[model samples]
Target: MSERKPQVLLIGFGGVGTIVSYTLEHLGRAEVTVVSRPETYDSIKSGYRIESCSYGIIDNYIATNVVKSTKEGYEKYGPFDYIIITTKNIPEISPVVDFLEDCYHESSTIVLIENGIGIEIPIYRKYPKAIILSGVSLIGTTLYEDTVKHIARDIIKFGAFINYNLDKQMQYDRCKHFLSLYSNDNNFAEYEENVKLTRWRKLVYNTCINTTCALTDLDFGRMDLFGGMESVVRPAMKEVVAVAKSEGVEIEDHVIDEMIRGEDGVYYPPSMLIDVRNGNYIENTVIISNVVKYAKRNGVPIPTLTVLDNLLKLVQLRTGEAKGRFELPEKRPLPEENYQIQFKY
Candidate 1:
């Protein structure tokens, strides 16, 4: 028998998926198959386009196959080596969980490249056979009918949550498989060890920037100049740091604060803000309520987080969206402030 070429199935053919598809195609390592709703599939098959503001050109991408949501989406294009998901977390994750159950397998790896905190464990509980990876993306994409406007240089950080230390070669092989999709451009992917901290750190930054920008209806550039935003931002960061500490993870306040300032302090609108602008479901429960729960558990008072959580709840209530499906997790009290601000190297 002839050797088989590597294959990848991309879920959520929205902004991020388009970028991944563009990069993977340019790299030319694996055959890409996109699984999206029917309308998105038609657009990709007919000819999907990407116009990059920074990169300076509109390019068209054609995938090997396009199928709407069905077992056929997986059955026809799978036994895929990797499934890269960029979908948002909503409705307590029922739809995505069902999708994963239908599509996940031991031979396939699922990489979550989306927003929010505290989502991976539930996925693991449901799909233990598949290798799960969590990632943080710092790229921006705007949609424009059968095309996405790639707004910034792609900065993707990803890593797996492996249970045991596998042999070096096995680990390297898995890493290599992932890197292949972005090999043509080394700027897109980085393998990180402190992946959980990385994810939480990014979330903390987003929670501040996205919510603030959305509320103020301003972009990051102007928002950065606004006075007293730090009062809200710093307090939220403290809650995030406290939660990380409770989980035995140490994250510096300055690191989180600086992270809130994006690349060159670029005035980009965050995903949450984008969702609110689009009138879509927001991640109030995961991002806001979780912080409140953790702070209450640690005996650390998060006055600002409570306020923000209440504000988010008001937004949901006024919009008549899904409210509080996730039960508040048990609280873990934080120790007294005996820590010094250790400078990050």
Candidate 2:
């Protein structure tokens, strides 16, 4: 057996893959291979370049390798120990199945770091023997050529579900392994047993931020203070709480209110807003529709979310969204008193 670094296979060489790969590279312990679409693979293999304000300038054409499809991807550089998926939700599950069918073994671990809630159960039911992990990523990275523009300083949450009856020691071992990868970095990773609850919590935040941001065509900072937009956030949050409560995800009404009031006032743009700005397909299927489905299942009325969902669908239909153009913004301005005050929560 060869004594070599652990091998990592990343599906979709988008922003998430960039950040994860950059981290893995800096950690100096993994051979990272990114599997992208044919068009993207060509671009990456030639040389990857990510121009960003945060990381100064990144050009990774030399180190990174990209291939198309799981079969070719695995054959060229895999039998990977870890597969991290950062694609949006609609096609997320399918490629995972393809990766598993073509290359992965019983020991390979799959980590999903995309938007949406409640996707894991279906994936788990089908791949009962596979090691499945779910996660939330706060780091933002976008692709420019083969390199990824990475915005550091974000937390990542990872773990298995509460309903999973897998061996506790195995779960702990997985957590330990992941932490070993990132623990030394400034931003930390935490593993939880109640990953479902964690997913729902992040979902609520996304439901409010993503829907409103896309519909109103505003980033977080603008919507947070937009008189008309901020007014709608509270009511939307009320509906989210009602639905979440029905689903047994306990979030205090006040905390929900605070989240909306706080996040909106600051200027962090959601992925939906970015996608819309860039003329990409909106992720309405998973975020907006799934919330409505879960609310209906629990007999909880989420009128606000439903209304926003419908409005966003109309916006997507009429405008035909796209991904945001990667123009690095000027330096962030000093926070105003209100902005500073709102973020205290």
Candidate 3:
């Protein structure tokens, strides 16, 4: 009998998603499909045009199937072996539960290839029997006209949720099966044991530098030139370290210091900053405000993160949900954010 290829479905086909799709399909390891917004659905159906110096450019790669919604996707091509989420960690607009209603099966693993802490809580609550996993993508990628420029090393730290008390061997088997789908030379994917600590480590950089870049409308390069890391980034990084330490994840002083400061005159804008420049809604709640809440519950104060969170909240009030069909509050007390970016959250 011929070996049956593992079937995989990937949701949130953004820059990161595109990178994974091509890598998986090119490997011929899994049957890949993408569930994306309707507007880009047709174009993605046409095929993803990909370009990366590290992994030669390919035009009109029709390797993966593309569909519009999770309902349509599950109806047509699921009970997939794996469903990976590559979108930003924003649960307010579309709760993770919405995607699982008609698609999830206990045997199938759900992989969240995004950032932020506390993301697993909701998924675990809703699908207690399902296998849940997460990844911290260490790549610098930006989308342009169906093309993704992968400028940084494409390394990903993936781990299954052991907090659910699933058999360790079972989880490892599932993780290995999912990890085998990618074969890109540039994409170095690995299994991680300390999932919570890993997420917090990344958060040290994100909650500090990413938040500052978004609030100031500057990229990493610009932020470096203006002494923003010293003036703004350090205090926030230290505050986040405090929160992480409260949660038993000891973030050393040098760890936060090494993360937030980058080489001067580098032009990489973190994802949140990119969202703001494009006049789109940033992942304000997940990366910033939510972390602040986590701090409060643990009795750790994050005054700087709080300030950054409030500032981005104001910025989004003006930037139209530029992504596509993402809606904003209609009747609100706050003025259009274009007035003046105030440090009040």
* Tens-place lDDT digits, model 1, residues 1-345: 955667777787777887777677665567777887865666778876778754456566777777775377678877788877777765343345666755666788777777766666566667654566766788878677887888777887777765343444464457556875664543567877677777778767766667766666677767767753575676677777777787667887678656655567466666667767777667777666766776687787777778777887667554443334333225533457454322221
Worst 10-residue lDDT window for candidate 2 reads 336-345
Choose the strongest candidate by lDDT.
Answer: 3
Residue lDDT tens for model 3, 1-345: 979777788887777887777777776778787887878877788776777756777777764577787778788988888888888776765666567777787767998887788887888888777787778888767677677776666789888876455777788777776776763556788878777788889988888888899888898888877899888888888888888888888877888666765644467888888777777667777777778988889988777888888887767666534444445455553665544323232
Off by over 4 Å in 2: 49-65, 91-100, 162-165, 228-230, 263-266, 314-345
lDDT-superior candidate, 2 or 3: 3
TM-score of each: 0.82, 0.80, 0.88
| Clash count, candidate 3 | 1
Off by over 4 Å in 1: 53-58, 91-95, 163-173, 260-267, 296-299, 320-345
List the lowest-lDDT window of 10 residues for candidate 1.
Answer: 320-329
**How close to the true structure is residue 221 of candidate 1, measured as C-alpha lDDT?**
69
State residue 179's C-alpha deviation in candidate 2, in Å. Answer: 2.6
CA RMSD per model (angstroms): 9.5, 11.4, 4.7
Better of 1 and 2 by TM-score: 1
lDDT (C-alpha) at residue 189 in model 2: 73
